[model samples]
Target: MIRTRTQAFRLTLGTLSFFGATAFAQDSHLPEIQVRGPRDATIGTADSASEGAAERESFQSRPKLRPGDIVEAVPGVVATQHSGDGKANQYFLRGFNLDHGTDFAVSVDGMPVNMPTHGHGQGYADLNFLIPELVSGVRYRKGPYFAEGGDFSLAGSASLDYFSALPAPFVDITYGSNNFRRALAAGSRTVGDQTWLGAIEIEGNDGPWDVPENLKKANAVLRYSQGSPNRGFSITGMAYKSRWTSTDQVPERLIASGQLPRFGSLNPTDGGNTQRLSLSGKWFDKGPEGETTISAYAIDYQFDLFSDFTYFLNNPVNGDQFEQTDRRRVFGAQAARTMPTKFGALDGVLSFGAQWRGDRIGEVGLYNTENRERLSTVRNDKVQQDLYSVYGQQLVYFSDRLRGYAGLRGDMLRYDVQGREPVYGALNSGRGHDAIVSPKAGLAFTLTPQHELYLNAGTGFHSNDVRGATISTDPASGLPADRVPALVKGRGAEVGWRFQPNEDLTATVALWQLKLDSELVYVGDAGSTEPGRASSRRGVEATLRWKLDRAWRLELDGALSRARFRGLAPEGEGNYVDNAVERVFAAGVTYIDGPWTASLRLRYLGPRALDTQNTVRSRSTMLLNFGGRYAVNKHLTLGLDVFNIAGKKGNDIEYYYASCTGGEVVSGACNGGVNDRHVHPMEPRSARLSARWTF
Candidate 1:
C-alpha cells in the first residue's frame, strides 16, 4: 500500500521517467487558439455557468469509482451512497440533502434522467447507464432562474452532452482491490454522411463488508448523428442493469457494545435489482434569424429493493424487512424556439418552449418480508401521472453594460391512482389535478470586460407522488389520511458576482436563499404521504480556479448554510431541519505535461444535526484521493487511482431512529426508542490500475 503523499508522488515521477524517452519521441505539436473574453461566456447566461469545453479533458484525466461521481464536477455538489450500488446515490448541494435527486434535475443528451414518484424515493436519478468517456461537456445552473428548467430543479440542474464521434477506438480493462474488475470498449465510425458510435461496459465488485456487496452491472449505448448542435439530428439507445447485496446502516450502540462491527449489518439479506431501457432522439435547426430544438424519448424501468432499517421494531416475528417495487413506462418530449427580437430602443432575444411527460406505472407497492420472502402486502396500486408545461422568456439589452431578463412558466399536473389491493379493507382510488404559474426575473451588470454582477429571483416547484395525491387512508394503520396537493411550491433569490482577474484566474461568489411552502413526501415504506412544515434555507458559496502554469491547475470551492423549519416548536424542542448539511468544501490540484498526468483532490463534509432537536449530531468526514497516468506508446497507456488514501474512519451516511434486535429487549419489549444512530461507514483505502489500448 502507498503510505504517504510523498511516496505516491515519487512513485508517479519514477514511472513517468521510465516512459518519458519513448513518449517524447512520438509527441507532436499542435496549434493553439486564444479568445479574449471569459471562456464560458458564450455557453452561460447571467444566472448560470458552464464548465466549458475543457471539462471533457478534465474528466478524462480524473479517476472516479462510479459513474455518478461525474456530478461532482459541478461546484458545491457532493455524491455519496449508503445502500447497494444499484440504487441512486444521495446528493447534497446548496443546503439541501437532495435525497436521490429530489430537488436537482439531471439530463443526458436531451433525455431526462430523474424518475418521478419512484418506489424508493421521488425524483430518483440513476446514472449507472452513462459511459463517462462518451461525455463531451457538462452545463450547470445554481438557481431556478432559467425558463427551460422545470420540476425537481428548485436547487439546481445539470445537462450532460455526449460526443457524436470519438477521436479513435479504444479498449480499457481495470483491476482493483476488493475483487473489483471492469472492462470497456468504445469507438465511432463514419457511415456516409452520418456518424455512428457504440460503447459497452461490464463491471463487478465485492466491497469490504462481512456480507460481500457482490455488485454486478452492465451498460450499453448506440448512437447515430449528423451535422452539429447548430443544425443536427441524432438517435440513441441505452440499456443498463445491475444487482447487488447491501449492508444497511447498523446502530452505533451495537458496534459500541461489540455486538456488531462497524461494517456489519443486522440483516444480511438486504439488496436490490434494477434495470432501465431507453430510446431517445434529438433534432435542431439553425436559420438565418433563429434556432429550434426538439427532443423525444421513451423509457422502460423496473426496481426492487429490500431494506431492513429497524430489525424488529415494527414486526418482531418478521424482523422488519420490507420490499419496495416500481415498474413503469415513461414517455416525454420537448420543443423550443429562439429568435432575435427588438422592442423600441432595446435589442434582445425571445425564447419559447414546451414540455410534456407521462408515466404509466403497472405496479408501485410496498410489502412486509422476511429473508426476502413476502409475508403481507401494505399497498399495491397502479398509477398514471402526466405533466405539461409551457414557458417564454425575453432578454433585453438596455446598453453595453446592463441587461435584463424576464420569464413566465405554467405547468399542469394530473394524477390517477387505482388500488390493486387494500390494506385492512381500506381502498384508495381517486383522481386529482393541479396547476401552477411561476415567474422569474434577473439583471446582469457588466462592471468590466472580465467582471460581472447578477441578481436573480425565481419560483419553482416539484410534483407530489400520484399515490400521495389521491390516497385517502393510511396503509399502516388503516386510518383516514389527509391527501396532499398535487404540487409543492418553492421560491428562491440570489445575488452573485463573477471576476476574471487575468487569463489564469477566475472566481465567483454568491449569497442565496430559498423558501418552501411545505416538505411533502410519499413515504414508500408506509405507502402514504407525510406532510412536513414550511422551511427556509440561506447560504453563501465561493469558488476559485487558477491555472498556475501551462501544466498545472488548482481549484477550490466551499459553501456554508443554515436550514430550519419555519413554525415554532414546543418549548425545549428545536426546529432544525434534520440531516441538512451546513458546510462543504472541495479542493483539487491537477498537473499535465506531455504524456503524463496527475491529480489530487480533497473533500470535506461537515457535521450536521440528525433530528429536529440539536441534541444528536454527526461527525464531520474528510477524504483524499489521487490519480496518475502515463502514456506508454501511441497505442498503449497505464493509469492508477487511489481512493480514501488516508483510510479515514467515517460514515457514508447516518440517521437517528428507533430500532430493535432479537437479543436486546427494553421494558420487556423488543422496542428501542429513537436514540440509536444508524450509520453506514465509509470504505477503506483502495486502489485501481488500468490499461488502455487505442487503435
Candidate 2:
C-alpha cells in the first residue's frame, strides 16, 4: 500500500479546463443509461436494491431521481411533516443534529450543494424546493465507506440524478398535499448521432409548521455526449434557484407552551433565497491497457437570509436587527484507470481535490436597536488535498460452488486551511493536513453456488480540525458555536453470509463495527470536545428476498446498530453527555405482484438524549405504502404512492451548544436555562400522493 501526500492543484486547474468552449454531443443510448455512486460506479455494480443487507445503501432508490412524497417510504428516515395545516417544515436524519455537516450530505451527481458554513451545521438544500415529477432518482448512503467528492463526510453521502430517458420532449404539471403544487419538463434528442439532454424543474409548497415555511424553486440542466459503444465523452451543467419564508426556531419555552406558529405569517428564524450551480464531465475509452475512464466536477452555493423577529424596523431612529447572509463554494476533481491483470484486475484511482469558501457575513438589525447591526465579516479559507490509491480484486473459482475475492486499497491525503473573518477567535486558517496511510482488505468464501461467506475491513477519517466549515458564534454569547468535531478517524470490519436456498429465495446477514477517535453527539448541548477518545459503532444487518417462479417478488431488510462514545469527559465536553443515540433498529418489506406493489417499514430507536443530563428515551415508528403500475397500453405506466398508513409520530433527539460555566455566560443575550439549554421536539404527521406517465 502506497500513501501519497502531494497536493492537487491538478483538480482545481482541471475543473476550470472543463468549462472551455469545447462541447461534445451525446450519442443515442439503446436500452438504459446507468447512473451510480462513487464506489459502486467503478466496481461495475448498480443493483443496490438487490445487494444483500451487508453493503452500504443509498437514501433513495436510484440516481437521476426527483422525489417529494418518496421520503416517507424509507425506514429510519423522516421529514418534519405537516398535519395538513401547512406548518413547521424541516427534516432530520439519524436523530443527529440537523444542519450541514452534522446531518446527511446532499449532492447532485457527486457534486456538493450544501452552503459554505458547514461546521456550524447549517444545511444548504431545503427538500421542499424539489419538484417530484422532475426526479430520476435520489440516493442516501449511511456510514463513511464509499468514495465521495469532498468535506462534511461524517454522515455519508446522498445524491440526486436527473435523466433523459423518454422519446422526444415533454411537460409535467401537478398539484397535491399541503396546498402543494409543481410544474416540470425534461427530455433528450439526437443531432448527427450526438445525444443532447436537458431538463427544468419548478415547485412550491406551504409547509406545516405553525409559522409555516413556504418555499419555491427553479432548477435546470443541460448535457452533451458523443461516442460509439467503444468510446464516449460527456459534458454537463446544472443551476438551482430557491426562495423560502423563514420559520424562526422556537425557544424551548414556547415549545413548552405547546404552541405552534400561526398560518400565513412570518416564520421567526430564517427565510429568503438560496442558489447553486454545478458543472461536470466524464470520458470513457476502451484501450489496450484495459478500460480507461476520467471524470471532473465543481459546485457553488449562496444564501441570502433574514430573521423572522426583526430587531430593527428599518427606521431612521435605529439601524436594522440581526439579519445575515452568506456565500460559500467547494470544488474538486478525480481520475482513475482500470485494466485486467493476470491476478484478476488491478484498478488505479487518483483523487485530487480542493475547496475555497468566503463568508460575506454582516448583521442587520430589525425590531430592537440593541440587536440591529450590519457588520460585514469577510472570511476566506481554502483546502488542497490529493489521494493516491491502488486496489485489486480477483474472482476465484474454488470448484464450482465457491467464488469471490480479496480486495484492498492504500490511501494518503493532506489538508491545508487558513483565512480570516471579523469574528476573531476561529482559526485564521491552519495547515490542517495529516498524512494517513490506511489499508483495505476483503475476501469471500463460497460454500456452494447457492451460498457464500464474506469478510472485509477498511479505514476512514473525518477532518482533523474540530471546527467545520461554518464558523458561527452564539448571537447572544458572541462565542463560537457547537457541532460535529473537525475530524473523526476510524476503521471498520465486517463478516457476513449470503445464501440461495432455492431459485425463489435469497438471504444475507452480516456483523460490522466502526470505531472513531472522537464521538459525535447530537443533544441538549451538542458537539462536546472529547480529544483522543474513540467511540465505536457495532451492529448486525440482514436481508431476505423471494422471487416466486414469475410475476411475484418479495424483499425484506433489517438493521440493528449500537453506537456510543467512550471515556468522555464532562468538564471538557466529552462524549458521555452527547445527544446522539446509543442503539437503533430498522426494517423494511416490499412485495410486487403483477402490475401492483405494496410495502411496509418499521424503525425502532433505542435510548437517546432527552435532556442535558443525557437522559435516554425510546421511540418506534411504522409506515405503510401501496403503489400500482398498470400498462395503459405498452408505452405508458401509471404510478401511485401512499404513505404513513399508521400515522405514528417519532422523535429524533436534538440539542444545541452551551458553555457549562460550572454554568457561566460566554457572551450577550444568551444566558441561563431555557435559551442556552437545548430543547428538541417531535415532528408531526403528513401525507402526499403522486402519479407519473412514462412514454
Candidate 3:
C-alpha cells in the first residue's frame, strides 16, 4: 500500500531512475511508458466475481427500442414494458419480478433514480429521461455484499457514469415505423480550466394499437466540470417531461371471441403525464492521504395517471376509471472516504460512508374518474419522510493468494403523514419510525494466474411506503388496518468463480440465494400497499465473453432460478411465488472492421408461474434485434436498426385476474366476472434509420 508521501515519492523516484538509465544506455532519445491502473477490475481486485464493469464501446451497437433497455447490458437482467413507453419498465433478475425496480437499485452520475413511495408504485424508476449517447460506462454488483448499496439493492445495483467530454459535437436524427421520430444534439467544450457539456432530445411515437398511443417527450441536460476523476468537481442540471396514452392488458377471452383486438384498449381515455427537474453536484479527490467523495442533489417531480384495469367490476355505471397523482420535492447528500492501511506487514484498505435523504410530498391522491374527468376524491395526504445511513468496511490481504472483507451498516427512517381529505384523511393520519443494522463478510482466493474464487454474504433492506407504515384504517372499506414496519429486511449469499484463460476470453459463474422477511406489494387500482408473504429464492448464473478474432466478438449469458413462499398458505394455495422468473438466456455477436460496425442479439425468456397455485403461467418469449452502421465519411455516418427481426409474436406481460368486460354479463362469464389471462402484446417488427453528423 502507498501509505505515506515518503513511500510514494520513493516509488516514483525508483521508476524514473530505471527509465533514465535505460534511455542513456539505449540511445540519445527516451522511450515513453504509459501507466495504467486497475480502476475497474473484479477478477483479482473485487470481493465478488459477480461484480464487473461494462465499457461504453461494448454496447454502443446494441439495438434498443426503449431507453430502459440500457440495464439489459448487465448480465442476467431483463427490462420490459407493459404500458406506455413513457412509464417505467418492469425488471426481472435472480428469480424475482422486481416490479418497477423494487429490489434492484439504479443510479446515474451519483444520483439515485429509484423513487420511494411513488404514486404509481414504490421504487418507481423511470428511465425514459436517460440519453444513452451521453453515458460512458456502467458498473454493477449483485448479492447485496457491498456497503455502498443502500435501499432497494437486495438483489442487485447498477451505476451509470456520463462522459466528461466528447470527442466531437454530434447531431443524430431518426425516423421509424408507426410514426416514430426522434432528434438529439450533444457536445462538450473546455473554457479555461472548466468544461461545459450540454445535450437535448425530442421524440414522438404512435404505436400499432387500435387506439393510437400519441406519446411525446422532451429531455435536456447541462453540466460543468473541472479536473479528473481522481480529483474533480462537477455540477449538473436535468429536465424531462412526457405525456402518453396507454393501452393496458386485455382479457384473453375478449381477444379470442373477437370482442377486442390484441392491442386494443378497453378505455381509450387512459393516459398519463409526468415531469422532473433536478440539480446535482459532486466533488472528489485522491492523494497520498486518502480518497474522498461528496455529492448532493435536489429534485422536483410531478405525476398524474389514469387507469382502469377492472372495467365495470367496481362501478358498472362509471366504468371503474380512476386517477393517481403525486407531487413532491426530494433532497439528498452523501460522502465517502477510503484510506490505505497496514496491519503488521499486511496491506489493506479501510472505507466508510454516510448518506441522508428526505422527501416532502405536497399532495398524493387517488380519485374516482370517468374518461378524463374526476368525479370524486378517494384519499389525499401529505407526507414527509427522512432516511439516514452510515457504514464502515475493511479489506485485508491475508496472503499472496487470499483476501478477506468485513463491513457493518446502520440505517434509520422516520415519516410523518397528514390527511388532506376530510373523511378519509381523518382515519389514516399518523407517524412512525424504524431502524435496522446489517453485517457483511466476504472471502476471495486466487487459485492461479487465470482463476479466482469468491464467497460473500450480506444483509440489506428496503423502505415501505409511508402511507402503509402509518395507516390506521382502510381508506376504501373504513375497516381497521394494521400498520407495516417502515423497513423490511433481506439476506443474501453467493459463491462465485472467475476464469481468464487469456486476454481474448473471460468467464464467470455464480450460485446465489436470497430471502426477504416481507415483500412490498402495491395495488395499482386502489393506490395502496398490501402485505406479501415472506419468500426465498436460489439461482445460478453464468456469463462468457470471447474475442474470436480482431473483427468478431461473442457474448453469452444465462440464468435459472426457483422461488417459493416461506410459510404454509391456504389449503388451495401453493408455495410458488407469483410472476417469479424461472429462466433467461441471451447471446450476441458483434463485427467491427474498418468503417463498418454491425451487431446481432438474441434474447429468450422462459415460462413463469403467474399464480401461487402453480396453475396459471405465462408464455415464453424470444426476440432478435439487428443493427448495422456505415461511415459515409469522416464527418458522417448512417445506421439501420431492426427490432424483433424475425417478427415473432409475443406478449410483453401477462396476468391472471378477474375482470368484467361488459360482454361478460351477457356471456355469463364465471357469474361475477371473467377469470382469465390478461396480456399486453409485444410491439411488432419495426425498422429505424438514423443519420449522424460530426462537427
Candidate 4:
C-alpha cells in the first residue's frame, strides 16, 4: 500500500542511525561530542567516570492535551492552576513562588522562559509552549548552585532539555475531542555521518472555558550535530509561536445555565504570544593527567501579549492596552576536569557567563487619548543589567555510605538605565552595579544498597535597582524612572530520603525550608513596580510513586503549604485586598489499567480574609477531573476526559467599590453598601471525548 511507504521510511532512518556512529570509526583523532544535559556546571561530580547514557527518547508517549500531560512527580513541588488548562499552570517548589521565580530556574533546550520584567508586567515563565512529547528529558535541582539571573531562585530549577539527536526521518500526528487536536513530525538524515534534524508540531484546545478563552499554538525545531565521542561541532535552532485566550470567570448562576467560561463568562479575550531561539556547543579532548571538556551555549527569548484585565472605577477604558515584551541573550563557557585523590575522586567544573536583556512595556489607557488626558504611563522605563559569574564545587566520597559536596560562586553585577519612562524602583536612583556572592553545600549517604538519604543547603542573591518601589512620584525629579525592582538574598535547605527496593517501584520523602532576607514582590498598576521587601513564606512538602505490576498502576500526589506574610502591609487595587496571608493545597490520584487510565484531581484552599475590616471570607472548594483511554488497535486510540466532575462551587476575590451597609461603624460590613467588582472564578464541570491515531 502507498501508506506503507512512510512507515518504511521511518524504519530505514532508525536503522541508518544505528550503524552511522560505528561507520565513522576510521578517524583516530576525532573530537569527542557530548550533548549537553542539565547545566549544573556549578558543582563537579564525585568521580571522573564515563558519562551516563544519553536519553534520546521523549519523556512520555504522547503530549496532546490528554496524552503527554507534563506530570510532576517529586517531593516539595506543587502545581498552581491559572484557569484555562492545567498546562498553563505554575510550579511552586521549596515553599517559594515560581511566578517569575528567581529562586527557581527553568530552561528548555537551554532557552530562558522567565520574563525579564516589562512585557505586560504580568510575565512569568510560560512552560506550555512545548508539548511534553517533544521533551528529551527534564532535570530538577533544588537549594542553590543554579545561577539563573532573571528571577530569584533560592529553592531550585526545573530545566527542560529538548531532543538534540536526530534520526533520518519520522512523522507523528494525533487528533482528539472537544475540538482538541495535535500533530508532530520530524526527520533527520546524515550527510556523510553529519546529522541534520528538523521538526514541527501544532496543537489546539477548545478548552472547558467557553468563547475566546480557547488556546492554540505551533512550534518548529532544526538541529545538527557532528564529531561524536571524537571531533567536530554541532548547532541547533528553533522557532515557536503561540496565542492563548483567558476568559475571566463569571457568577455560578450564569455558568449553571451553561453560558459562562465563554461568551457568558465574566471577561474574555485575555491572551498572549511567545517566540525563542537557542544554541549550544561542546568540545572534549584527552589530557595528560585527566580529561578536559569545554562547553558553551547562547539563548534568546522574546514574549508578546495583548491581555484584558478586570477593572473598577477611575479605571481607564482602553483597559490598559496590555503589551509586555522581553529580549534576553546569555552566553557562557564552562570547563571541568577530574583527578584521582587518595581518599576519593576529585572533580570540579568552572563556568563564566554574561547576561543581556531588553524589555519594552507600555499600557494604553482605555480612556480616549483625544480627551487630552494623558494616560498614566506606568513605565516606559527600560532597565538593563550586565551579569558575570564564576562558580566551583568539589565532590568527596569517603565510603560507599558517605559522600558530600561544597560549592561557592562569585558575581560581578552591574546595571544601566536606558530611558526615563514610568518605572518602579527602590527610591528612584539609577544605581549601575551591585556585587553579590552566593554559596551551596550538599551530602548524600546510603543506609543500605537500596536506601539513600541526602541533605542540601544553598544561598542565592538578587541584584536590586532603586528605580521603582513606590506608587506616586514627583515629575520634577526628571530622573529616569526606577522600573526595575529590588533584588534580595534567599537561604534554603532540603533533606530527603529515597528508596528503590526493586525495579518495579520507588518512593521518596523530603522536608524543605526557605527563608528570604528581603524577598522581592511586585504587583500591577500599584506603584513603582520595584519588588516589595515585606514578603516571605515557609512550608513542608512531600510526594509518592508506585507501579503495581505494569498493567495495574496507581500514583498519589499532594502538597500541604502554610504560606503567609512575615510582617508587612500593602495596598491593592481594592481597599478590601492587601498583603494578607493565604494557603493553597493541590492533590490528585491516577490509576492505569490495560489501555485505560483514570485520574482524580483535588484543590483545597484555606479561608482567605479580606484586606479590609469588612472581613469578607473566601471559602474553599474541591474540583474533580477524570479521564480514560483505550487503544482499539495498533495505531488508533479512544479517550474521554472531564474537568470539575462534581460541579464544585467556584471561588473568587471580591473588591467593594460601594461602602459598608449595616453593622457598627468601621465594621467593614457589607450591609448592602457592597460597592465592588468580581475577578475570575473557577471553571465548572465540562467534558470532551477524543480519538487519536499515530502513523
Worst 10 residues of 2 by lDDT: 16-25
Q: Alpha-carbon error at 311 in model 4, in Å? A: 1.5
lDDT of each model, Cα atoms only? 0.76, 0.42, 0.80, 0.45
User: Which stretches of model 3 miss by more than 4 angstroms?
Assistant: 1-40, 522-529, 666-670
Clash numbers, per candidate: 0, 64, 0, 52
Better of 2 and 4 by TM-score: 4
Q: Write the per-residue lDDT of candidate 2 for residues 1-695, one digit (tens) a residue.
A: 11111111222122212211011112223214422211221011111111211111223321111243344233333444221211113333343433324334555443444433333224334443343433444444444333332333344445544443345466555555455666667777766647787788877776555555567778888877776545777777878887766444333333444443322222344455667676787665654444444556666655454442322222223322234444545455444444433323322222222222223222111112222234443333443333333333332333232233343333444444444443543444444333443444445454454566766665656543322423355433466655334444667667777676554676767677777676433322221122334666666666565655455555555655555566645573434434444444445544455555444444454555543345433344344434434445443444443444455444333343332221112233324332332232333344444444544
Worst 10 residues of 1 by lDDT: 22-31
Among the numbered candidates, top TM-score falls to 3
Q: Mind giving the per-residue lDDT tens digits that candidate 4 earns over 1-695?
A: 11132332232222211111110101111112223322211111211010011122212322223321342433344444443541235444544444333445555554445543434333355666664544554555455533322344455555555554532244555444446666777766665647666788787776555564456777777777665543445566666666666553233333454644323443354455556656665444433233344556665655544433322212323333334444555454454343322332422222223333333222211121111233454344445555555555554554445556666666665655444453433233354655567777777666665566777777776544323333235343445533443456767666766665654455555566666665444343231124544334545444434456655444444444443445544554222223232454545555555666656555554554433343555455555666666777766667676766787755533222342211212353434333333334555566656565544
Q: Sort the predicted structures by lDDT, highest score first.
A: 3, 1, 4, 2
Give per-residue lDDT, candidate 1, residue 514.
90
Candidate 1 lDDT tens digits, 1-695: 11232332232222221111100100010101011111233202334332222345565566787788888878888888888778787788887777788888888776778887778777888887788877765556777776767888888877666666777889999999999999999988876557788899999998888899999999999988776434667788999999999998888998988988878878889999999999988776756567666778899999999998878777766688989899999998887776667688666677788889999999888889999999998878888989998998887767666667899989999888888775532368888899999999888776776777888899989876767777778777878888777788999988888887675787888899999887643232242235577889999988888889999988888999898988897686678877788999999899999899998988999999887897899899998989998999989999999999999998877777777776764345554444678888888999999999999
Candidate 4 TM-score versus the reference: 0.71
- Candidate RMSDs in order: 9.2, 9.1, 6.5, 10.0
Evaluate model 4: give its lDDT.
0.45
Native-to-model Cα distance after best TM-score fit, residue 382 in candidate 3, in Å: 0.8
Global fold similarity of model 3 (TM-score): 0.93
Candidate 1, residue 525: Cα displacement in angstroms equals 6.8
